[model samples]
Target: MSRMNRFLYSLADGLKGILRNLMMSLMSFSMLIGSLLVVGSLSLLVVNIDAIIQDLGDQNEIMVYVHEEYDDSEFNQISQAIMEAEHVVGFTFVSRETALEEMKNDLEEYASILEGMEQDNPLRDGFRIQVDDPANVEAVVTAMEGVDGIGNVEARTDVVESFLKTRNAVNLISIGLMVLLAGISTFIIMNTIKMSAYTRREEIAIMRMVGATKGTIRLSFVTEAMIICLCGSIVSFFAIMFLYQELIEKAFSSTGLLQAVPFQEVWGGVLLIFVGASLVIGVLGSLLSINKYLKV
Candidate 1:
């Protein structure tokens, strides 16, 4: 028989063996599905969080405040320095009138406060600069210090700092949860594989007596594992789509949050992660159980 034909026969035989032990196969497949679903959900959450952070970075803008007594030459020099920074995308100078007008529009409740300070307004002229990285806002602010006419710099520092810290914390939490879930899944899958192998002990012994090579014996178990995992991956893909549209998208949309979550862009990655995770768990479980049974 050709090598391809032999492989096909071996595959067919392996599948038949699994079908012959239908109960064990179903149990194994069920465990695989549960494990992969958890893995896929975590992966999708992480990916979407990362996308949200990217959008925030792209939209981040910094405001540099200039001192009251500083000369126009000093302001020009400070503006020129900021414009040269690599992280800076663009910069615009906000004149005193313009700043006052913006504040008047934004602070409707404080209209009297502005009217009282018409001539002696403490608000300073400033430059609004957009940067490539939200994380680099502090660095850009630091670079602007001591340049002529610079009184104090405020670029949503508190908001940006909080966001970075929160993003990192979320990532760490996601990783911890993923590791914990994976361990539980591995334990469950390993137990299931052991049970399946134990129940087929007699058949395995008979195959060995028939001069079956160790490779063939091991391949049979591994093939069953891969089939279970592949099926679970297919199922998890549909489950993720349902969850994304029905639960995730709806919840965020109701709150007017993450209006542009880029669901479709991240969908492919989520599927890839589920397939890869399922395959790893399945292969590991099968190998471990097969090794233990062979020793027995």
Candidate 2:
């Protein structure tokens, strides 16, 4: 028989063996799903949140201020110099009128304090420059200094740095949790598979005496493990979909942090994690358990 056929036949036979212990298999599958859901959910949450944070960081562009009395020719020269900078991604000019409008929108509480001060608007007009990377912000800032018509460059360095630090800390904690949960999941699945093997020890011995190859025996157990794991993964996916839509989406949309987190992207990431986790747990646990039985 072809290798493919052999694999299918072995898998089919394994399914039959598992079916003979239907109640036990169902119970094991349930446990696998629960363990994987815990691990996969946390992994998905971390990855999605990290992506959102990165998007926010990417939008952290530098705002370069210009002197109020600076000439138009000097302003154009400075704009051109910023555009030609090595690390410059994009630059947008905020005219005096635009700056005043922005200030008005932000400071509605102090409307009376500046209700009629059109000519007294002290905010400087400037170019908002975006760099290729947050790390290269200092390079961009240094390049902007002393450029004609530019008063000073402000990068919001402290705020962006704090955001990066928080992102890294969150990612680190999530990674630690994922590793711990993965270890626990492997332990549980292995024990469950071992129990299955123990329960079928006599049957396995009988098959061995009847000239069953180790490959066949191993494949059968592995098939059982795969089934259990796949079922658990499917359950976790639906559960996450429901929870994400009903709980996370509904709650966050009301608060307007919804745009900060893209729902579909997060869902896709979570689905991948859930499926990948299921496969790893199912295959690894089966291999470990079947190897022990093969020695006997």
lDDT of each: 0.74, 0.74
For candidate 1, the TM-score is: 0.83
Can you tell me which runs of candidate 2 are displaced by over 4 Å?
1-31, 54-59, 68-77, 105-110, 133-139, 145-149, 260-263
**Mind sharing the TM-score for model 2?**
0.80
Worst 10 residues of 2 by lDDT: 257-266
Error of 2 at 31 (Å): 4.8
Clashes of each: 0, 0
Candidate 1 per-residue lDDT over residues 1-296, each given as its tens digit: 65576567657755775677677667766766776676666666666666676767777887878877787688678878887876888989997778988999999998987896668777778888888888887788788775667777777767667767776876787688677766766666666667667877886788778877666777767777777777878887888788778888888778876753656877777778878887887778778777755643
**What is the TM-score of each predicted model, taking all chains together?**
0.83, 0.80
Candidate 1 wrongly placed segments (more than 4 Å): 17-24, 84-86, 104-122, 292-296
Query: lDDT by residue for model 2 over 159-233, one digit each (tens)?
Result: 656656766776787678667766666666677677778877887888788888887777767777787777778
lDDT, candidate 1, at 193: 63
